[model samples]
Target: MSNHQNPTHSIELTREATNRYVARNAAGVEVTFGRGEDLMSPVELLLAAIAGCSSIDVDTVTSRSSEPTEFKVEASGNKIAEENGGSHLEDLNLSFNLSFPDDEGGRKAAGLVDRLVKLSHDKYCTVSRTVEHGTPVAFETEISVGREEDGNKDTE
Candidate 1:
């Protein structure tokens, strides 16, 4: 999908109790819940949304280039009390590590990282864009090639 286009995704949530819910995405991915018990804390969910969106964009862009690729994305952010009675999330940081087929593949993969971030922060990734408007968000990416011993390559 192009950055100029926004795809619609539907999320269905069933409230299990006060501050507790079970949510499912359009793809039938099921997520169970509790207020702060499960992995669905508000902040955690937001980070997940951002990570998911960016990862999808990167995968799509890289796959279209006909290069074999695999990726794992992990995101974390800290919230500091706002000064002057403002909103929470004073600062947010997101880090991504992308593993490619080889050194050149790593470089090419890295090249797409920024584009993914831009698409997410500027045009797509509704969750990231929405959160960024309220707080300062920073992103960092690292790219590396998967080693043959990493069980990522076929051996003959």
Candidate 2:
């Protein structure tokens, strides 16, 4: 059997306060976070990571597929405290709406979405797997076609 492994990656953070901190990567992307008076405390950054990962994955996969496509992704989650003390997200959802030409191509697009999500979550997206161990993740996709001039898509 061929042995393959995903590269291990890490993020470093510096604590700022009881509920605030800053995170950055070697490439210099920085993110500042705080509790913001919410029940979830501070792991919202992880949710954003999952969302961003899936979004990029979907867009890339669709664009490289049999048809030209454009899309957007939105991800959200509910956080609940675990019995042991730490909080965990309860329900995480990701929604993808894509636009492409032709109904036949759209159908193929749907199948491609399944493969994309699996590849992202299972093989590539560390954020998704990490969150999944703590909570349930769900995803949905909608396919459409054509673009309009007003900075918005006109779906049929």
Candidate 3:
């Protein structure tokens, strides 16, 4: 695949506390996250991303037939911390539940969701594809240290 074909998403974070951060996405949407009980953990966000990506695919196809009366997705996963550092999700599970009107159009939409979900898991959803393929992540870090008298100094 061409690198140019890939979509890039960015997140900016502001430190609110030692374990708290306000994360903002490329679209200026902000999400507060931390180690606190009330905040969404990083692992939860990962599962959410996976489920959301697939749900959007199914929703698009289902909506083409008829509007869904209700839609919901529940995602869960087991996180195993590595001996060195970081962690990975295992046994990922996603349950998709949706409702539609009790009519022919609704029945067609309902069936469409199932087909679209299979398509998403097989090819359409980027998040699912990345997870299934073990896509390599290249990391680059740049540090800027500025002083009152001196301008910004960059170090990598």
> Number of the top candidate by TM-score?
3
Candidate 2 lDDT by residue in tens digits, 36-137:
664333556667688888877776667664564566667778878889999756678878666677777667766788778878878777668766666454
What's the distance in Å from true for residue 87, model 3? 3.0
The residue-by-residue lDDT of candidate 3 on 19-95, one tens digit each, is: 88898988899988878888988778788899999999998888888888999999998889999898788998889
Tell me how candidate 1 scores on lDDT: 0.70
* lDDT score for candidate 2 against the true structure: 0.71
Off by over 4 Å in 3: 1-4, 83-86, 144-156
Return model 3's CA RMSD, one decimal.
3.0
- Which residue pairs clash in candidate 2? none
Question: TM per model?
Answer: 0.60, 0.59, 0.83
| RMSD of each predicted structure | 17.9, 17.7, 3.0
Q: Which 10 successive residues of model 3 have the least lDDT summed?
A: 147-156
> What's the lDDT for residue 117 in model 3?
84
Cα distance off (Å), candidate 1, residue 36: 5.5
